[model samples]
Target: MPASSSRLSSYRLPAFALALLLLLGVGIASVWGVSSLRTSNEWIGHTYEVINRIEVAERAIRSTEANARAYRLTGHPEFRSQYLIATHQVDTAHEALASAIRDNPAQHARVKRMREAAQAHLVELRRLFDLQELQGAEAARQATNSTLTLRQWNEFDTAASEMRREELRLLDQRKARSDRSATLLSAIVVLGMLLSGGLMISLMVSVTRENKRARRLELEARGAAHEMALSMAQVGELSKQRHELARYSGLLQSCQTLDEIVQLSIDTIRRLVPDASGRFYLIRASQNFHDSVASFGDHLISSPDSLMPADCWALRRGQAHMVSGEEARQLSCAHLDTGTPAPGITSLCLPLSAQGTSIGLLHVSAATDAMDHGSAVDELIGQLAEQLGLAIANLQLRETLRTQSLRDPLTGLFNRRYLEESLARELQRCERRNLPLSVLMLDVDHFKRFNDTHGHAAGDALLGQVGRQIQAGVRAEDIACRYGGEEFTVVLPELDAAGALVRAEQIRRAVEIATVQHLGQQLGPVTMSIGISTFPGDGLTPEVLLQLADATLYRAKAEGRNRVLHVSYDD
Candidate 1:
């Protein structure tokens, strides 16, 4: 019996030793799990940062393209400045992305390809600008319309997409590893707690303490895992927002008019912020007031149709103005205030500015009592404002360039170039409709002698008055052009020889009665000779018709100064 007791005691000591070893193993596992979780969190954050850098690089590339195209189209100094800035941004973004992903060979290769594509795109843009300068806008436009630039853009986009996909793949793998680590840590903690329950009375206090510590570590790890998941979700949300912004910007680039841009902006904003109501207000040409170009969503009170620039705080301060909940009732713009208080409403006003000039305003409101107005919303607003501003500015610049190219500056009439183009088009149209077209050639009588006596400035004043008189005399469908020095031409569609004679007589009488004053000195009365030619009767081609009309004008000058002549008058 004593021998049996001795053997049992020996078994008890080894059992206690085995339990202690198990506790130690659990402690080591708890520490390892905490370290693994921290490392996984860090890697997750690194992946997100790398993704952010890639997105920024992509945006920079798009900006470079847009600014380059603008500069090519208008040759505006502001567009050039913007192009330089965008190019710099592209370089900086590429450098940062490359540095961030240097450790990954595959990602590094992708980035290298992306850089090559971007460099090629920039080189092509430079070539286009040089072509514009050396050749003309038409040659540059043709080059831009070619596929070479588009191919480079596509290559860069492909490379960027690959890089992003690879990063996301890595993120998934890392997340899986983190999940396994978390699961293993929880299992180890649970096993330790179960084993500690069987320990001897003398070891109970130490085992209990160790179990408590392990449970605490488990809870902390679970909390961290939750945070990491939330962070991943946030990253995904940010990525989605960026994609939406990119799509919106691409659409804006395709808009050719202010109205199109305004409508598109309203639709995009509504889609992006479903809970928000908004309006877009554009500054008029006179800069005196803001007109509401568009509005979207349901509001408690409709926004003003027009408001003075001073009525809005965003335009006044040239920045964003935001107010939320009860604060909105006190800080809202005068244009928005309906003298009624709005509860739980958030209002944001962002001034749309481009090239250091304020072009318009964007106003939005959302019921934010149930939702927070977080940084994501702010970021979206800022991006929308910037893209909309640039688009509107570029459209306006293009319109201005087109008008200047087609019209004469001094006379406010179509130039000789426009006249030639319109004459041919009108002849074709008249033939198509089985109608007649007329061309009128006009000359200022004794314009050289008048200039010698009254000075060139006075002659300019006389020409200006005659141009206005000619324009006023022509029908809305007729085209009046400053043909050259002391000469004018008008293309009249659907006008017969008789009709053109009457119109010429009217123009002649108007110019004869018109008086000119320059530098407070009244000049002599101005008179012009008119010669008319009709299509199918005079000639079929524009050159032939113009030649016949010019010959008739010489005959008119020989006969009398202020008389109208027709090509058929001699016949």
Candidate 2:
């Protein structure tokens, strides 16, 4: 486990969120700027409108003055009508100026002054006109030249000038202010554009980089997952291997022969390689061939009767052999049938070897479309072969040791030690079952005299013949042991004294009829004097029963050379 190579902490904000915030801020600034620009333009437009209205008012006043001068000069009724129209135009212009400047208190005051001056000038013109009409034109001219008229006309011109000048001054100030606002708005818009463009580019690049990073992270995560799956599979394989080895080791403890060991291996391998059929081929060293001793699961190919050493690739190569389905069809082992292998079939052959000597081969088959064969599976199967080989070898060695310990080499029957041990067990069993158990103590008649007459080989042959006869005469369930030199014992279970005597007579007759041939010389015939002892009637324990039976045999030997004799319990 190395540390991860990701730096997700460095990327706090996602690209979309950053882009959203940037767009929102740009939009808000754009809106605010547009609003500001519109307000500034409105103020600038208001100044122009106010200036135009003031100019109209000034023109109207001057026009009225001209009309009044014309009336005084012409002294006609048409002139009066023109003066009245001019007066109406002047009043309308003043009202328009007033309405236009309503929002500006200072400009409104200037409009108010212009209105008063026009009113006073109109009054003066009306009075002069009245004088001219009532008196004469000369009288009107005199009245117009009056100081009140002159002062009124001067006041009207001054007020109109003042209003125009004030409006012009205010317009200049407002125009300058609006121009600044416009400039600021333009600058804001331009700067905003540049910033937003740069920011947008930056965001785009960041998002691209983020996307790349995210994709890289995803790849790393996927790789890590694949690696983890591989690691888990390897771990599971190792655990199963350990468990399998342990289980086989335990099973080997109870196996007394190579057959049991092979069966155990077959059962285990079937579970380890699921959906795969397998078989164990034990090498018959003397036969020069391999035999299918055990098989488990299913296989694409059926097991054969036997395969020669050259028939297997694993045996020939002295190593594990593997073949994919396609490869197997081209070059499969000779042990398989003489037909084209199935498609999508996988096969593995492991040579079971121990101590550098190949003893057997393990063959397994699985479908190609199934699980992929990892190295771990291969290694485990190899280990299983090794374990199977070792376990079988160990059991075979144990069997050899066991036979040496328990069997008599001369007669190939259970030795005296085994007999005593078995006798004790039978006694215990008889006590539990409340059944009668009997022992037949037998000795060859005149064995010492025969050994003295013949060679040791002849005596050994004679003893072996007697041992075989006893073995053949007893029931399969009976225990026959070579107790000592020329003495044998057979234990019979669930038999009473009468039954024991009948079996003893049978063994006695078997010995009487048996012959021994040594060095091409056929000896006449042999006989055994048998002594019978039953449980509880003779003794309870094995030692006591054997002692009493031996004594009874001494009685039979005394009575005759060859005879089975049993003592009555009620003497």
Candidate 3:
């Protein structure tokens, strides 16, 4: 009986030791589970941070590109400042991303590639800026429009996308790891609870508390991830908008004429804002009213063909004026109020100005129910206004310069240089079409004797009067130039010798009867000797025609001062 009691005691000690070991194992397993969950949560957070940094970098890069383009287009100091700010932001974001992804070799390599691409893009932008400063906006615009710049931008975009994709992949992997960790921890707790009740009850309580905390953290992480996705989508949309704006701005800068500007603006505005109808009004040279040079969409039928500056609130105020259905108390532009707008319509009128001078107005309207009345759309409209203003101003300046270069100041006729160019071009056309062209050389009779008798001012007055008479008698297609001094040349396209003779006689008679007044003193009647030369009959080339016509003018002067003479084909 004593031996039996001793054996039972031995079995009791072994059982107690086994129970102790099992408790220790469960405690160690719980600790390991908790640690694993914490590591997983940390990794998930890291992944989110990396993704956020990548997006920030991408946004900064786009901002840099946009502001750089703006600087090149307008050459405004403000755009340069904004560009610098955006470039700094890009550097900051790149550094942060690099730091965050240093632990991942593949991600780090991708970031490196992104940084290189970004640097290349930045260098290209710097080149454009320098070009704008040194060579002018047109030169910079040409550089910006090059395919190399676009390709570099694409490379940067590709690098950014790759980096973003890599981060997203890592996020997925980390999230999966976190899920596995959570599942394993939950399973361990359940098995421990089943193996032993009393010891595991305390462990279960602690683990349950931990599990609740972990689940709360996971929910927060998921919410943050969802929000991040939404932010990324918004960023992408904004990026696309900026890209389109930049591309269109480049195109606008390259436009050479007002007609081209209007056509391009119409197409761009329509494409960018498909839901809206709009009109572009330019202040006419008369400065009295605005002419609607272009209109788009169905709603434009209600718009006027022309409007006074006072008709537009934007023009009158020299700022943007907006009116929505909700703002019934707002005063709409006279131009718009005259038209019947759709119900619940929103309209925006932006004054187009450059260098503090108002040049035009851009009017846009849309039905509120059919479109998004957001700040983004308004911002885009504002940008369009600015771009259009600069383009139009530049075109006007170019045209003014070109006209000054080509026209004679005193007579308002084309100069010798323009005459030569036109004659050459006309000769080419005439040759191509197998048509005849005529050249007339008209000289004021006794221009030096008249000056000596009546003083130089009277001679000038006589010459001016004769030039006016000649211009008034020519057809719309005729090209007239003050050949040099008292000599004038007129090019008549599609005119044979018979037609040329009749035109020359009319010019000579017109000049003969014209009166001249200089400094309130009446001068004698002005007469000019007209000599006519025809292409294919007298000469084929402009130089030959001009020389032969001049010789015929000498013959006219020797024969009779006021009579018109044709080339003597008999010679």
lDDT (0 to 1) per candidate: 0.85, 0.78, 0.82
Q: Write the per-residue lDDT of candidate 1 for residues 191-267, one digit (tens) a residue.
A: 98687557665455545655786788888799789988988886876677677788888899899988888888777
Please give the RMSD to the true structure for each candidate, in Å.
Answer: 33.0, 34.7, 33.2
Q: Model 3 has how many clashing residue pairs?
A: 0
Winner by TM-score between candidate 3 and candidate 2: 3
Pairs with backbone N, CA or C atoms under 3 Å apart (clashes), candidate 3: none
The candidate that wins on lDDT is: 1
Residues 1-571, candidate 2: write the lDDT tens digits.
1122234323334544565665676577678767776776777677678778877877887777787778888877787888888889988998888888788787677678778978887877778878877897788887665677677667766766776677678767867776776677677667656765675676566567668878888887997799899889878876876688678778777887766776777677656666778788877868598888877776676657678888888888898877775774456788875663566876777888788877778888777544254546666667777877787777667778988999999888889998988899988998999999999899998999899889778999998998888888888889989999999989998899999988998888888887888899999497788888999778899988898899889888888769888865332
Model 1 scores a C-alpha lDDT of 0.85
Off by over 4 Å in 3: 1-231, 337-340, 369-374, 569-571
lDDT of 3 by residue, 453-492 (tens): 9988787777778778888999999999998899999999
Highest TM-score among the candidates is held by which one? Answer: 3
Candidate 2: pairs in clash = 277-298
- Among all windows of 10 consecutive residues in model 2, the one with the lowest summed lDDT is 1-10
Candidate 3 lDDT score relative to the true structure? 0.82
